[model samples]
Target: MRIDYVINKVAQTHRGQSEGDVAQAIHDQLRAVGVVPNGRQIAQYANAISALPQLPPNATKR
Candidate 1:
């Protein structure tokens, strides 16, 4: 799987959720797609996603 796809998934599911929650959600999503990622890896992704800057409400893709 692409890193960008994982990043986007993590960002989408991170809102109003704790790190553990995000990790579990990501785990489930990946599992359904046959990618059994390790817990530590998922945790790292969650942590990294949380560190990303939040886009403004009016922000647009360019």
Candidate 2:
């Protein structure tokens, strides 16, 4: 699964929830869908994705 996609989806759907909450939710969903990632793994992935910078559409590339 795409980590970024999952992160964005969880963020959009779980607004107001804590980062850990959102990460756990994604972990649970993945488990239900037959992809098993441990809680720690999920948290690490979530943290990395959260740290990514958000750029606007008007931003120019170097």
Candidate 3:
């Protein structure tokens, strides 16, 4: 699970929202995405992000 990809996904889903809003949206999405697939969403999200230095990217960004 890529945090940057997740964050980008959340941002696109939540277009026009501020960065903080985007962050919250990502958190919620993470929880939603985690509960049913590989494992607990929150736990997976937490562990995935806990070691990260920052959020992911938007390949188009220069």
Candidate 3 per-residue lDDT over residues 1-62, each given as its tens digit: 65567755754455454544544566666567673333345344444444444445778899
Model 1 CA deviation exceeding 4 Å by range: 2-4, 52-62
Ranked candidates, highest TM-score first: 1, 2, 3
lDDT digits (tens) for residues 1-62 of candidate 2? 55556656765566454567667788977766677677787877667545555434455656
Native-referenced Cα lDDT, model 3: 0.53
Instruction: Report the Cα lDDT for candidate 1.
Output: 0.70
Worst 10 residues of 1 by lDDT: 52-61
Sort all candidates by lDDT, best to worst: 1, 2, 3
Query: Model 1: per-residue lDDT, tens digit, 1-62?
Result: 55457657768657446677777778877777777688788888877766666545655756
Task: Point to the candidate with the largest TM-score.
Answer: 1
Using TM-score as the yardstick, the better of models 2 and 3 is: 2
Which TM-score value belongs to model 2?
A: 0.49
Q: Which candidate is the best by lDDT?
A: 1
